[model samples]
Target: MGERGVQVGGRAVLPGALRPWLGGIAGLGAVVLFGLGVLFAGDSRPGVVDLRVWAVVNGAAPPWLYVAQAMDFLGEPVGAPLLVGATVVGCLLLRRPRAAVLVVLGVGVTVGVAKVLKSLVGRTIHGDNLSFPSGHTAFFTSFALVVALLVAGWLRVGRTVGVPLVLASTLLAAAVMGWAQVVLGAHYPTDVVGGWCTAVAVVPVVAWGVDRVADGRR
Candidate 1:
């Protein structure tokens, strides 16, 4: 519907609004496609095997493995968690409690849903059933979304320019993180796509709903 901006770090930023809906739909599409790939093709198929082989091959390179290791660290506590935790605290300090709450809930739901889907789907890699969805990818995607929304709301920059810039940059970073997971043999391609979809599907809806409730209260 309508768009609004909040102040963060002394700049105006836009909260979750239309972008969330658009992103949610796009993400849902990815999830659906990949879920079908997983269900119909099964893990032993050529598509899955080929991608995994490529990742393993490229990953053997010193440079690629180094990059994967670095990206892997980001998904850890000192990386995504630290970044998200700090961002949440920043939103609270800036008096945007709803944004902070959205960050927490969005990430929580993304992780929780990923876990459930992985369990139900029962895809395995390296003897781990959790391979159906890459938790690292989801975490990084949610982290990017939080930062993007926070920056949009904090900067007075027009949504037309700011939203696209933030989204593009964040999505690129998220993609890199997903690639790293694949390179490290941590997940299948479908798993990484599934993770990205989870964040897209969950974050926007939850953020929008939180904003709506906050508006109702006001």
Candidate 2:
């Protein structure tokens, strides 16, 4: 598709020219593998890697703790909706309705899946709080993915540039959220990994589906 030809149904949808579906597939595989590992490890206990990472991240200096709390707030009830709403409004202003829909579905579905998986995995931290996949991490990562995809589409960049842009954005968001979750004692390091992977597994497919539906209607 040409740069301007990427539109569907007279709206600027996801750029179908860039190939993110392959990354989506790999993400799904990672989620499954991580889930199986969680199951095998049983409940409420940190793995070897989790222990090491947690040891490093769980305790923080006072100043750094404040920074972590600020980052954590972005995933909290008050902050999350604000972020999502802002992104949706921004997409609408840019005339990218499909991208706006994607931001909604991407964040909602990713966080929803994390919640469901917490029940299925039955992993707990700090007593009865389920924490297999950190919902906060998933929320931020999903939002980041949607934003990156929208930016890539807007820039009309191809896989060579788009892929790196998306990956870098995703990794940065995930790392920040993951650190906050760990530092706050909300989840283990592996739980943060699961949440990050969930967003990676979900957002591209959601984008593709949005594009497919828009194209079908057209």
Candidate 3:
């Protein structure tokens, strides 16, 4: 099945067949869980309570809110420009042009599918919907995950060099973006979960498909 996802030290195994099928499975689980939360969050009051809990934990005023909203400092498409460029460069550098193209497709699918899920379920966003499975969160997460995983394998350096540092920082950025989504009230918790699920599933599955094609061509 040519399972090759997020390899670490040449020994890392994908959690599944590293195929589209597995990605679909992961995605479905995420959707089901989100639906359950929507259906049985007790009631609107309960939902509000849960949100308030997060608000308190995030502090009376989340710094991310200011950071996200300050358009003059940082406009929309926060990561889009960087992501497009990075995906292209990463593909070229890795000699995985097909994988790179597939990643773009995968990200597109994530956004499209998220919209379908939101509309089909008619799940009203506590924050906003058209907002189910936060596109911004998913988009940035996919960006980080793709860059991290793609570059991770090729990063060979002297043993003394900190190989894991870059990957860790990328992952940390994704985490921060997810936190920002929550703090900014751009998405609810479930929306963030859905966003993450959409990304991991799509990227690995798409990459797996790309690998098959590239290997065949070779």
Candidate 4:
């Protein structure tokens, strides 16, 4: 290769190398923001918020408080099995089995980090229930949004219309999940926002990995 060809290729390689580092920084930012929110929110908002009002407005639970707490303990709204099903559907439809695997890994990593962070840096809800960045919100948003991105690009949606539509719908779903997180007292608004920022960081990187895996298989 000529000198110019070598120089251009070297620079292109540098940009590609930086991409993963940038992604890690974004994930770290999510943790920091979530920590800050928890620190500043101390003694300001109720940790669990207003349960009766939420129940009345959302028709969310049984008349019994124990029953509601029981449901929360069981993770009624965003059940693990349901989330797994959605992830599976998205991965299969997009022909990216590896993306599903990556998602599981991402979620596992996030949960571990969240638990550790919650104990070390953030707030204690109950005796041991850590309540900083909501794991449920992060997982759902990350999984849903990243899957949307993968499907959009995998379909080769043109910039003119299809791609934008995919994004719009993805944002809508993310929004609903965020709202649910807050209303259900699983998270504060900022916790959900931080989770989104985290998702923006991890999802794309994971999707890229999945895409490459799928492409290689083909």
Best by lDDT: 2
Q: Model 1, range 1-218, lDDT digits (tens) per residue?
A: 24442222322223534454456565765667466546733353325654665655566478878988999998876776777788788888988777788788878787787777777666677764456667888888877776676676656445576657556855776689888887787777766767777777677766666665665524
lDDT of 4 by residue, 79-113 (tens): 75576667777776866556566667555555555
Q: Candidate 3 at residue 33, lDDT?
A: 45
Between prediction 2 and prediction 4, which has the larger lDDT? 2
Better of 1 and 4 by lDDT: 1
Better of 1 and 3 by lDDT: 1
Write one digit per residue (lDDT tens) for candidate 3, span 48-163: 64476476646325464576554112214554655576768767686666556655766666566666766654545453345556566566666665555444434532223322
- Give the residue spans of candidate 3 off by over 4 A: 3-49, 57-64, 70-79, 93-95, 126-128, 156-174
TM-score of each: 0.77, 0.89, 0.64, 0.57
lDDT of each prediction vs. the true structure? 0.67, 0.79, 0.53, 0.51
lDDT of 2 by residue, 106-198 (tens): 899888988887777788888888887889988998898888888887788777888788778878998999998898888888888787788
Greater TM-score among 2 and 3 belongs to: 2
User: Per the 3 Å backbone cut-off, how many clashing residue pairs does candidate 3 have?
Assistant: 0
Clashing pairs in 2: none
Range of the 10 consecutive residues with the lowest summed lDDT in candidate 1? 5-14
